[model samples]
Target: MGSTSSGRSTGARDRDGEGRARNARPRDGLGRPLPYEAQGVARQPEGIVRTPEQSVAEAQGLLDAGRPFHAHEVFEDAWKSGPQEERELWRGLAQVAVGLTHAARGNVTGGARLLRRGAGGVEQWAAQSGRQRPYGMDLVGLVAWGRGLADDVEAGGGTVDAQARAPRLRGQVP
Candidate 1:
Protein backbone atom coordinates (compact mmCIF):
# COMPACT_ATOMS: atom_id res chain seq x y z
CA MET A 1 0.00 0.00 0.00
CA GLY A 2 1.35 3.40 -0.98
CA SER A 3 0.53 6.54 0.93
CA THR A 4 -1.04 9.46 -0.91
CA SER A 5 -0.05 13.08 -0.38
CA SER A 6 -3.04 13.44 1.94
CA GLY A 7 -1.73 10.58 4.15
CA ARG A 8 -4.32 8.05 2.93
CA SER A 9 -3.29 4.60 1.78
CA THR A 10 -3.67 4.15 -1.95
CA GLY A 11 -5.11 0.65 -1.93
CA ALA A 12 -6.75 -0.52 -5.12
CA ARG A 13 -10.52 -0.43 -4.87
CA ASP A 14 -12.72 -2.99 -6.56
CA ARG A 15 -14.68 -1.43 -9.39
CA ASP A 16 -16.93 -2.46 -12.20
CA GLY A 17 -16.09 -1.76 -15.83
CA GLU A 18 -18.08 1.45 -15.70
CA GLY A 19 -15.99 2.67 -12.77
CA ARG A 20 -18.66 2.15 -10.19
CA ALA A 21 -17.28 1.06 -6.83
CA ARG A 22 -18.16 -2.56 -6.20
CA ASN A 23 -16.55 -4.46 -3.40
CA ALA A 24 -15.43 -7.90 -4.53
CA ARG A 25 -14.13 -8.82 -1.13
CA PRO A 26 -15.00 -12.18 0.31
CA ARG A 27 -17.32 -12.06 3.30
CA ASP A 28 -17.98 -14.20 6.34
CA GLY A 29 -21.36 -15.76 7.12
CA LEU A 30 -22.43 -12.55 8.86
CA GLY A 31 -21.28 -10.45 5.85
CA ARG A 32 -18.09 -9.11 7.36
CA PRO A 33 -15.48 -8.51 4.77
CA LEU A 34 -12.46 -10.83 4.96
CA PRO A 35 -8.88 -10.43 3.86
CA TYR A 36 -8.52 -10.52 0.09
CA GLU A 37 -6.51 -13.76 0.24
CA ALA A 38 -8.92 -15.58 2.53
CA GLN A 39 -11.38 -18.10 1.17
CA GLY A 40 -14.97 -17.22 2.05
CA VAL A 41 -18.49 -18.45 1.65
CA ALA A 42 -19.96 -17.93 -1.80
CA ARG A 43 -22.03 -14.80 -2.03
CA GLN A 44 -25.63 -14.76 -3.22
CA PRO A 45 -25.86 -13.39 -6.75
CA GLU A 46 -27.88 -10.21 -6.82
CA GLY A 47 -30.94 -9.20 -8.90
CA ILE A 48 -32.23 -12.68 -9.71
CA VAL A 49 -35.99 -12.86 -9.83
CA ARG A 50 -37.83 -15.76 -8.20
CA THR A 51 -41.33 -16.79 -7.44
CA PRO A 52 -42.61 -15.95 -3.97
CA GLU A 53 -42.38 -19.58 -2.92
CA GLN A 54 -38.83 -19.87 -4.20
CA SER A 55 -37.80 -16.70 -2.40
CA VAL A 56 -39.22 -17.92 0.87
CA ALA A 57 -37.59 -21.31 0.53
CA GLU A 58 -34.17 -19.92 -0.37
CA ALA A 59 -34.20 -17.29 2.37
CA GLN A 60 -35.39 -19.86 4.88
CA GLY A 61 -32.57 -22.19 3.91
CA LEU A 62 -29.99 -19.46 4.38
CA LEU A 63 -31.48 -18.52 7.73
CA ASP A 64 -31.39 -22.14 8.86
CA ALA A 65 -27.72 -22.32 7.94
CA GLY A 66 -26.98 -19.31 10.17
CA ARG A 67 -26.28 -17.07 7.21
CA PRO A 68 -28.68 -14.27 7.95
CA PHE A 69 -26.64 -11.86 5.88
CA HIS A 70 -27.13 -14.01 2.80
CA ALA A 71 -30.78 -14.41 3.74
CA HIS A 72 -31.08 -10.63 3.80
CA GLU A 73 -29.79 -10.49 0.23
CA VAL A 74 -32.46 -12.96 -0.84
CA PHE A 75 -35.14 -10.82 0.75
CA GLU A 76 -33.62 -7.75 -0.88
CA ASP A 77 -34.05 -9.39 -4.26
CA ALA A 78 -37.69 -10.01 -3.50
CA TRP A 79 -38.16 -6.41 -2.44
CA LYS A 80 -36.65 -5.22 -5.70
CA SER A 81 -38.42 -7.65 -8.00
CA GLY A 82 -41.75 -8.35 -6.38
CA PRO A 83 -44.96 -6.35 -6.67
CA GLN A 84 -44.82 -2.75 -5.55
CA GLU A 85 -47.53 -3.21 -2.94
CA GLU A 86 -45.50 -5.95 -1.27
CA ARG A 87 -42.19 -4.12 -1.24
CA GLU A 88 -42.54 -3.09 2.39
CA LEU A 89 -43.09 -6.71 3.41
CA TRP A 90 -39.94 -7.93 1.70
CA ARG A 91 -37.92 -4.95 2.86
CA GLY A 92 -39.06 -5.58 6.40
CA LEU A 93 -38.03 -9.23 6.12
CA ALA A 94 -34.63 -8.15 4.87
CA GLN A 95 -34.25 -5.80 7.79
CA VAL A 96 -35.10 -8.59 10.20
CA ALA A 97 -32.46 -10.81 8.60
CA VAL A 98 -29.92 -8.01 8.84
CA GLY A 99 -30.89 -7.54 12.47
CA LEU A 100 -30.11 -11.17 13.12
CA THR A 101 -26.79 -10.74 11.34
CA HIS A 102 -25.96 -7.79 13.55
CA ALA A 103 -26.98 -9.71 16.65
CA ALA A 104 -24.81 -12.66 15.67
CA ARG A 105 -21.92 -10.28 15.01
CA GLY A 106 -22.14 -8.82 18.55
CA ASN A 107 -23.70 -5.43 17.75
CA VAL A 108 -26.52 -5.68 20.24
CA THR A 109 -27.80 -2.11 19.95
CA GLY A 110 -27.95 -2.11 16.16
CA GLY A 111 -29.45 -5.59 16.20
CA ALA A 112 -32.29 -4.63 18.54
CA ARG A 113 -33.09 -1.40 16.72
CA LEU A 114 -33.25 -3.02 13.32
CA LEU A 115 -35.36 -5.88 14.64
CA ARG A 116 -37.94 -3.54 16.12
CA ARG A 117 -38.03 -1.37 13.01
CA GLY A 118 -38.41 -4.35 10.71
CA ALA A 119 -41.14 -5.87 12.86
CA GLY A 120 -43.04 -2.61 12.90
CA GLY A 121 -42.79 -2.29 9.13
CA VAL A 122 -44.13 -5.78 8.55
CA GLU A 123 -46.86 -5.45 11.14
CA GLN A 124 -48.11 -2.23 9.57
CA TRP A 125 -47.96 -3.73 6.10
CA ALA A 126 -49.95 -6.75 7.20
CA ALA A 127 -52.57 -4.60 8.83
CA GLN A 128 -52.98 -2.50 5.71
CA SER A 129 -52.89 -5.39 3.25
CA GLY A 130 -55.06 -7.71 5.32
CA ARG A 131 -52.95 -10.63 4.19
CA GLN A 132 -51.68 -12.17 7.36
CA ARG A 133 -50.47 -15.36 5.67
CA PRO A 134 -49.08 -14.08 2.42
CA TYR A 135 -47.15 -16.70 0.46
CA GLY A 136 -47.48 -19.16 3.33
CA MET A 137 -45.76 -16.70 5.70
CA ASP A 138 -47.38 -16.09 9.04
CA LEU A 139 -46.96 -12.33 9.18
CA VAL A 140 -48.46 -11.96 12.63
CA GLY A 141 -46.26 -14.63 14.04
CA LEU A 142 -43.15 -13.29 12.34
CA VAL A 143 -43.79 -9.81 13.73
CA ALA A 144 -44.16 -11.17 17.21
CA TRP A 145 -41.06 -13.28 16.84
CA GLY A 146 -38.98 -10.40 15.52
CA ARG A 147 -40.07 -8.05 18.27
CA GLY A 148 -39.49 -10.68 20.90
CA LEU A 149 -36.04 -11.41 19.55
CA ALA A 150 -35.27 -7.69 19.65
CA ASP A 151 -36.22 -7.51 23.28
CA ASP A 152 -34.22 -10.60 24.13
CA VAL A 153 -31.15 -9.41 22.29
CA GLU A 154 -31.28 -6.05 24.03
CA ALA A 155 -31.73 -7.70 27.41
CA GLY A 156 -28.92 -10.19 26.87
CA GLY A 157 -26.42 -7.51 25.77
CA GLY A 158 -24.30 -9.93 23.79
CA THR A 159 -23.98 -11.79 20.56
CA VAL A 160 -26.94 -14.06 19.89
CA ASP A 161 -26.97 -17.54 18.38
CA ALA A 162 -28.25 -16.91 14.90
CA GLN A 163 -29.16 -20.53 14.18
CA ALA A 164 -30.87 -21.06 17.50
CA ARG A 165 -32.82 -17.84 17.09
CA ALA A 166 -33.82 -18.14 13.44
CA PRO A 167 -37.48 -17.39 12.91
CA ARG A 168 -39.94 -19.88 11.48
CA LEU A 169 -41.22 -18.04 8.39
CA ARG A 170 -44.30 -20.14 8.15
CA GLY A 171 -46.69 -21.51 10.72
CA GLN A 172 -46.56 -25.07 12.09
CA VAL A 173 -45.42 -27.63 9.57
CA PRO A 174 -47.44 -30.81 9.18
Candidate 2:
Protein backbone atom coordinates (compact mmCIF):
# COMPACT_ATOMS: atom_id res chain seq x y z
CA MET A 1 0.00 0.00 0.00
CA GLY A 2 2.29 2.75 -1.20
CA SER A 3 0.78 6.20 -1.67
CA THR A 4 2.18 9.44 -3.00
CA SER A 5 0.23 11.42 -0.31
CA SER A 6 -1.95 12.99 -2.98
CA GLY A 7 -4.83 10.53 -2.54
CA ARG A 8 -3.36 8.55 -5.39
CA SER A 9 -1.87 5.08 -5.28
CA THR A 10 1.52 4.50 -6.85
CA GLY A 11 0.69 2.68 -10.05
CA ALA A 12 1.46 -1.04 -10.13
CA ARG A 13 4.56 -0.84 -7.91
CA ASP A 14 7.09 1.43 -6.30
CA ARG A 15 10.83 1.07 -6.13
CA ASP A 16 12.79 2.02 -3.08
CA GLY A 17 16.01 3.99 -3.03
CA GLU A 18 17.92 0.76 -3.57
CA GLY A 19 15.76 -0.06 -6.57
CA ARG A 20 13.97 -2.81 -4.72
CA ALA A 21 10.23 -2.90 -4.64
CA ARG A 22 8.97 -0.71 -1.81
CA ASN A 23 6.54 -3.39 -0.77
CA ALA A 24 8.90 -6.29 -1.31
CA ARG A 25 8.74 -8.73 1.58
CA PRO A 26 10.89 -11.53 2.91
CA ARG A 27 9.88 -15.13 2.61
CA ASP A 28 11.18 -18.59 3.49
CA GLY A 29 12.55 -21.08 0.95
CA LEU A 30 9.03 -22.37 0.51
CA GLY A 31 8.04 -18.84 -0.64
CA ARG A 32 5.71 -18.14 2.25
CA PRO A 33 5.70 -14.59 3.54
CA LEU A 34 6.60 -14.14 7.15
CA PRO A 35 3.69 -14.34 9.52
CA TYR A 36 1.90 -11.06 10.24
CA GLU A 37 3.13 -11.01 13.83
CA ALA A 38 6.73 -11.57 12.71
CA GLN A 39 6.84 -9.09 9.83
CA GLY A 40 9.37 -6.66 11.20
CA VAL A 41 11.20 -9.62 12.60
CA ALA A 42 13.92 -9.33 15.15
CA ARG A 43 17.05 -11.39 14.52
CA GLN A 44 17.17 -12.91 17.95
CA PRO A 45 14.71 -13.55 20.74
CA GLU A 46 14.99 -11.49 23.90
CA GLY A 47 15.33 -12.92 27.40
CA ILE A 48 15.12 -16.52 26.28
CA VAL A 49 18.19 -18.43 27.43
CA ARG A 50 18.73 -22.14 27.33
CA THR A 51 21.45 -24.31 28.78
CA PRO A 52 24.30 -25.24 26.42
CA GLU A 53 23.18 -28.86 26.45
CA GLN A 54 19.65 -27.87 25.57
CA SER A 55 20.77 -25.61 22.77
CA VAL A 56 23.02 -28.26 21.20
CA ALA A 57 20.31 -30.89 21.45
CA GLU A 58 17.73 -28.67 19.82
CA ALA A 59 20.08 -27.74 16.98
CA GLN A 60 20.91 -31.40 16.44
CA GLY A 61 17.24 -32.32 16.22
CA LEU A 62 16.61 -29.66 13.62
CA LEU A 63 19.62 -30.81 11.61
CA ASP A 64 18.48 -34.41 11.80
CA ALA A 65 15.21 -33.38 10.21
CA GLY A 66 17.07 -32.04 7.13
CA ARG A 67 16.52 -28.47 8.23
CA PRO A 68 19.97 -26.97 8.75
CA PHE A 69 18.55 -23.49 8.31
CA HIS A 70 16.27 -24.10 11.27
CA ALA A 71 19.22 -25.52 13.19
CA HIS A 72 21.04 -22.25 12.54
CA GLU A 73 18.22 -20.48 14.34
CA VAL A 74 18.76 -22.57 17.46
CA PHE A 75 22.49 -22.07 17.33
CA GLU A 76 22.04 -18.33 16.88
CA ASP A 77 19.75 -18.25 19.91
CA ALA A 78 22.43 -19.95 21.95
CA TRP A 79 25.03 -17.53 20.67
CA LYS A 80 22.84 -14.61 21.67
CA SER A 81 21.58 -15.90 25.01
CA GLY A 82 24.29 -18.18 26.35
CA PRO A 83 27.39 -17.18 28.22
CA GLN A 84 29.86 -14.96 26.42
CA GLU A 85 32.54 -17.61 26.75
CA GLU A 86 30.52 -20.04 24.62
CA ARG A 87 29.32 -17.51 22.10
CA GLU A 88 31.97 -18.35 19.51
CA LEU A 89 31.13 -22.03 19.63
CA TRP A 90 27.46 -21.36 19.08
CA ARG A 91 28.20 -18.90 16.33
CA GLY A 92 30.47 -21.36 14.62
CA LEU A 93 27.85 -24.08 14.71
CA ALA A 94 25.30 -21.69 13.25
CA GLN A 95 27.69 -20.89 10.45
CA VAL A 96 28.01 -24.55 9.62
CA ALA A 97 24.24 -24.89 9.40
CA VAL A 98 24.02 -21.87 7.14
CA GLY A 99 26.75 -23.33 4.94
CA LEU A 100 24.80 -26.54 4.65
CA THR A 101 21.72 -24.55 3.75
CA HIS A 102 23.63 -22.84 0.98
CA ALA A 103 24.81 -26.16 -0.39
CA ALA A 104 21.27 -27.47 -0.29
CA ARG A 105 20.30 -24.47 -2.37
CA GLY A 106 23.04 -25.15 -4.95
CA ASN A 107 25.55 -22.48 -3.92
CA VAL A 108 28.48 -24.82 -3.75
CA THR A 109 31.26 -22.27 -3.90
CA GLY A 110 29.73 -20.07 -1.23
CA GLY A 111 28.84 -23.09 0.82
CA ALA A 112 32.35 -24.53 0.66
CA ARG A 113 33.87 -21.23 1.70
CA LEU A 114 31.48 -20.77 4.59
CA LEU A 115 31.93 -24.33 5.75
CA ARG A 116 35.69 -23.90 5.88
CA ARG A 117 35.37 -20.62 7.76
CA GLY A 118 33.02 -22.19 10.26
CA ALA A 119 35.30 -25.15 10.80
CA GLY A 120 38.14 -22.79 11.56
CA GLY A 121 35.95 -20.87 13.97
CA VAL A 122 35.21 -24.01 15.92
CA GLU A 123 38.90 -24.69 16.29
CA GLN A 124 39.25 -21.17 17.61
CA TRP A 125 36.37 -21.86 19.92
CA ALA A 126 38.16 -24.89 21.29
CA ALA A 127 41.35 -22.90 21.88
CA GLN A 128 39.61 -19.92 23.46
CA SER A 129 37.24 -21.94 25.61
CA GLY A 130 40.14 -24.13 26.83
CA ARG A 131 37.95 -27.16 26.36
CA GLN A 132 38.17 -29.64 23.54
CA ARG A 133 34.52 -30.48 23.99
CA PRO A 134 32.73 -27.58 25.58
CA TYR A 135 29.05 -28.05 26.27
CA GLY A 136 29.70 -31.73 25.57
CA MET A 137 29.92 -31.16 21.84
CA ASP A 138 32.43 -33.07 19.76
CA LEU A 139 34.13 -30.03 18.30
CA VAL A 140 36.68 -32.02 16.40
CA GLY A 141 34.02 -34.16 14.86
CA LEU A 142 31.93 -31.18 13.82
CA VAL A 143 34.95 -29.50 12.32
CA ALA A 144 35.73 -32.59 10.33
CA TRP A 145 32.17 -32.76 9.11
CA GLY A 146 32.33 -29.17 7.82
CA ARG A 147 35.65 -29.77 6.18
CA GLY A 148 34.44 -32.96 4.58
CA LEU A 149 31.50 -31.15 3.06
CA ALA A 150 33.76 -28.42 1.76
CA ASP A 151 36.09 -30.98 0.26
CA ASP A 152 33.23 -32.76 -1.38
CA VAL A 153 32.04 -29.49 -2.87
CA GLU A 154 35.48 -28.74 -4.27
CA ALA A 155 35.85 -32.23 -5.65
CA GLY A 156 32.60 -31.74 -7.48
CA GLY A 157 34.14 -28.76 -9.30
CA GLY A 158 32.20 -26.17 -7.33
CA THR A 159 28.79 -27.46 -8.15
CA VAL A 160 27.05 -29.64 -5.62
CA ASP A 161 25.33 -32.75 -6.85
CA ALA A 162 21.58 -32.53 -6.62
CA GLN A 163 21.59 -35.50 -4.27
CA ALA A 164 24.55 -34.33 -2.21
CA ARG A 165 24.24 -35.42 1.41
CA ALA A 166 24.40 -33.32 4.53
CA PRO A 167 26.20 -34.30 7.72
CA ARG A 168 24.35 -35.84 10.62
CA LEU A 169 23.82 -33.76 13.74
CA ARG A 170 24.16 -36.39 16.44
CA GLY A 171 26.85 -38.16 18.47
CA GLN A 172 30.55 -37.48 18.70
CA VAL A 173 32.59 -36.98 15.53
CA PRO A 174 34.03 -40.47 16.09
Candidate 3:
Protein backbone atom coordinates (compact mmCIF):
# COMPACT_ATOMS: atom_id res chain seq x y z
CA MET A 1 0.00 0.00 0.00
CA GLY A 2 3.01 2.31 0.35
CA SER A 3 5.12 3.54 -2.55
CA THR A 4 7.49 6.40 -3.26
CA SER A 5 7.10 9.04 -5.94
CA SER A 6 9.10 6.85 -8.30
CA GLY A 7 6.56 4.04 -7.77
CA ARG A 8 9.10 1.90 -5.98
CA SER A 9 7.98 -0.10 -2.96
CA THR A 10 8.48 1.92 0.19
CA GLY A 11 10.88 -0.62 1.61
CA ALA A 12 8.22 -3.18 2.29
CA ARG A 13 10.85 -5.87 2.04
CA ASP A 14 12.51 -4.59 5.17
CA ARG A 15 11.55 -6.25 8.44
CA ASP A 16 11.50 -4.92 11.94
CA GLY A 17 12.81 -6.79 14.98
CA GLU A 18 9.46 -8.50 15.21
CA GLY A 19 9.87 -9.82 11.65
CA ARG A 20 7.00 -7.64 10.52
CA ALA A 21 7.48 -5.94 7.17
CA ARG A 22 8.32 -2.29 7.61
CA ASN A 23 9.03 0.66 5.45
CA ALA A 24 12.65 1.78 5.08
CA ARG A 25 11.99 5.05 6.81
CA PRO A 26 9.74 5.69 9.76
CA ARG A 27 6.20 4.33 9.63
CA ASP A 28 2.94 4.23 11.49
CA GLY A 29 1.93 1.28 13.63
CA LEU A 30 0.72 -0.37 10.43
CA GLY A 31 3.98 0.46 8.62
CA ARG A 32 2.75 3.33 6.50
CA PRO A 33 5.15 6.24 6.09
CA LEU A 34 4.70 9.70 7.58
CA PRO A 35 2.80 12.19 5.46
CA TYR A 36 0.94 9.09 4.41
CA GLU A 37 -1.09 10.74 1.66
CA ALA A 38 -4.21 10.10 3.62
CA GLN A 39 -7.32 10.96 1.67
CA GLY A 40 -8.91 12.50 4.76
CA VAL A 41 -6.17 15.09 5.39
CA ALA A 42 -5.15 15.86 1.83
CA ARG A 43 -7.62 18.72 1.31
CA GLN A 44 -10.89 20.14 2.48
CA PRO A 45 -14.02 19.83 0.45
CA GLU A 46 -14.77 23.01 -1.48
CA GLY A 47 -16.82 25.70 0.28
CA ILE A 48 -16.40 23.93 3.58
CA VAL A 49 -15.18 26.13 6.37
CA ARG A 50 -15.38 23.89 9.41
CA THR A 51 -16.12 25.52 12.72
CA PRO A 52 -13.95 24.93 15.77
CA GLU A 53 -16.65 22.73 17.16
CA GLN A 54 -16.47 20.59 14.06
CA SER A 55 -12.69 20.56 14.03
CA VAL A 56 -12.43 19.49 17.67
CA ALA A 57 -14.64 16.51 17.14
CA GLU A 58 -13.16 15.49 13.81
CA ALA A 59 -9.54 15.90 14.77
CA GLN A 60 -10.00 14.21 18.12
CA GLY A 61 -11.55 11.19 16.49
CA LEU A 62 -8.66 10.80 14.11
CA LEU A 63 -6.03 11.30 16.77
CA ASP A 64 -7.61 8.76 19.08
CA ALA A 65 -7.62 6.24 16.27
CA GLY A 66 -3.84 6.62 15.73
CA ARG A 67 -4.37 8.45 12.48
CA PRO A 68 -2.47 11.63 13.22
CA PHE A 69 -1.88 12.31 9.54
CA HIS A 70 -5.61 12.30 8.96
CA ALA A 71 -5.98 14.52 11.99
CA HIS A 72 -3.50 16.95 10.49
CA GLU A 73 -5.68 17.25 7.39
CA VAL A 74 -8.66 18.10 9.55
CA PHE A 75 -6.66 20.78 11.36
CA GLU A 76 -5.26 22.01 8.06
CA ASP A 77 -8.78 22.56 6.80
CA ALA A 78 -9.50 24.67 9.83
CA TRP A 79 -6.30 26.66 9.36
CA LYS A 80 -6.99 27.24 5.69
CA SER A 81 -10.76 27.75 5.75
CA GLY A 82 -11.85 28.57 9.26
CA PRO A 83 -12.31 32.10 10.57
CA GLN A 84 -9.39 34.49 10.25
CA GLU A 85 -9.42 35.35 13.94
CA GLU A 86 -8.77 31.70 14.82
CA ARG A 87 -6.14 31.00 12.20
CA GLU A 88 -3.31 30.78 14.69
CA LEU A 89 -5.26 28.40 16.88
CA TRP A 90 -5.99 26.10 13.97
CA ARG A 91 -2.46 26.38 12.68
CA GLY A 92 -1.06 25.38 16.04
CA LEU A 93 -3.38 22.41 16.21
CA ALA A 94 -2.31 21.39 12.72
CA GLN A 95 1.32 21.61 13.73
CA VAL A 96 0.63 19.42 16.72
CA ALA A 97 -1.01 16.86 14.49
CA VAL A 98 1.91 16.93 12.04
CA GLY A 99 4.30 16.55 14.94
CA LEU A 100 2.37 13.55 16.13
CA THR A 101 2.55 12.17 12.62
CA HIS A 102 6.32 12.55 12.73
CA ALA A 103 6.49 10.71 16.01
CA ALA A 104 4.30 7.94 14.67
CA ARG A 105 6.86 7.52 11.91
CA GLY A 106 9.70 7.24 14.46
CA ASN A 107 11.34 10.55 13.55
CA VAL A 108 12.12 11.56 17.13
CA THR A 109 14.19 14.64 16.37
CA GLY A 110 11.76 16.11 13.86
CA GLY A 111 8.81 15.10 15.97
CA ALA A 112 10.16 16.78 19.09
CA ARG A 113 10.89 19.99 17.22
CA LEU A 114 7.44 20.19 15.68
CA LEU A 115 5.68 19.24 18.90
CA ARG A 116 7.37 22.10 20.78
CA ARG A 117 6.77 24.58 17.99
CA GLY A 118 3.07 23.80 17.75
CA ALA A 119 2.62 23.73 21.51
CA GLY A 120 4.32 27.12 21.84
CA GLY A 121 1.88 28.80 19.47
CA VAL A 122 -1.14 27.47 21.26
CA GLU A 123 0.32 28.15 24.68
CA GLN A 124 1.43 31.65 23.72
CA TRP A 125 -2.04 32.64 22.56
CA ALA A 126 -3.56 31.55 25.82
CA ALA A 127 -0.81 33.14 27.91
CA GLN A 128 -0.82 36.49 26.13
CA SER A 129 -4.46 36.94 25.12
CA GLY A 130 -6.02 35.61 28.31
CA ARG A 131 -8.18 33.26 26.28
CA GLN A 132 -7.68 30.24 28.42
CA ARG A 133 -10.17 28.16 26.49
CA PRO A 134 -9.74 29.20 22.93
CA TYR A 135 -12.07 27.24 20.64
CA GLY A 136 -13.89 25.97 23.71
CA MET A 137 -11.18 23.32 24.10
CA ASP A 138 -8.48 22.91 26.74
CA LEU A 139 -5.49 24.45 25.06
CA VAL A 140 -3.39 24.17 28.18
CA GLY A 141 -3.75 20.43 28.40
CA LEU A 142 -3.13 19.89 24.73
CA VAL A 143 -0.04 22.07 24.81
CA ALA A 144 1.28 20.27 27.86
CA TRP A 145 0.71 16.93 26.24
CA GLY A 146 2.69 17.98 23.18
CA ARG A 147 5.49 19.33 25.32
CA GLY A 148 5.61 16.21 27.43
CA LEU A 149 5.83 14.02 24.36
CA ALA A 150 8.54 16.23 22.93
CA ASP A 151 10.51 16.11 26.14
CA ASP A 152 10.33 12.32 26.21
CA VAL A 153 11.54 11.96 22.65
CA GLU A 154 14.28 14.53 23.11
CA ALA A 155 15.61 12.84 26.21
CA GLY A 156 15.56 9.38 24.68
CA GLY A 157 19.14 8.39 23.88
CA GLY A 158 18.00 6.90 20.61
CA THR A 159 15.17 4.76 19.18
CA VAL A 160 11.95 6.18 20.53
CA ASP A 161 9.08 3.78 21.03
CA ALA A 162 6.73 6.11 19.26
CA GLN A 163 3.57 4.07 19.46
CA ALA A 164 4.07 3.35 23.12
CA ARG A 165 5.25 6.88 23.81
CA ALA A 166 2.40 8.68 22.01
CA PRO A 167 0.49 11.14 24.16
CA ARG A 168 -3.23 11.53 23.96
CA LEU A 169 -4.65 14.67 22.39
CA ARG A 170 -7.13 15.48 25.08
CA GLY A 171 -10.07 17.43 23.67
CA GLN A 172 -12.21 18.81 26.44
CA VAL A 173 -15.26 21.00 26.12
CA PRO A 174 -14.58 24.39 27.65
Per-candidate count of clashing residue pairs (backbone under 3 Å): 0, 0, 1
Compose the digit string of candidate 2's lDDT tens values, residues 1-174.
575544546565546676867444444531234643345422323235788788878767666656677678788888888878878888888888888877766687888888898889988988876877776677887889899988887787554432235555454455
- Please give the RMSD to the true structure for each candidate, in Å: 3.4, 6.9, 9.4
State the lDDT at 18 in candidate 2.
69
Ranking by lDDT: 1, 3, 2
TM-score of candidate 3 against the unseen true structure: 0.67
Model 2 residue 62 distance off true place after TM-score fit, in angstroms? 0.7
lDDT value for model 3: 0.70
Better of 1 and 3 by TM-score: 1
Q: In model 1, which regions exceed 4 Å deviation? A: 1-10, 172-174
lDDT of 1 by residue, 28-128 (tens): 88899987667999999988999999999999999999999999999999999999999999999999999999999999999999999999999999999
What C-alpha lDDT does candidate 2 achieve relative to the native structure? 0.70
Tens digits of per-residue lDDT, candidate 3, 52-140, equal 78878777776666667667778888889877777788788888878877776668888888989999988886776788676567788
Clashes of 2: 0
TM match of model 2 to true structure: 0.69
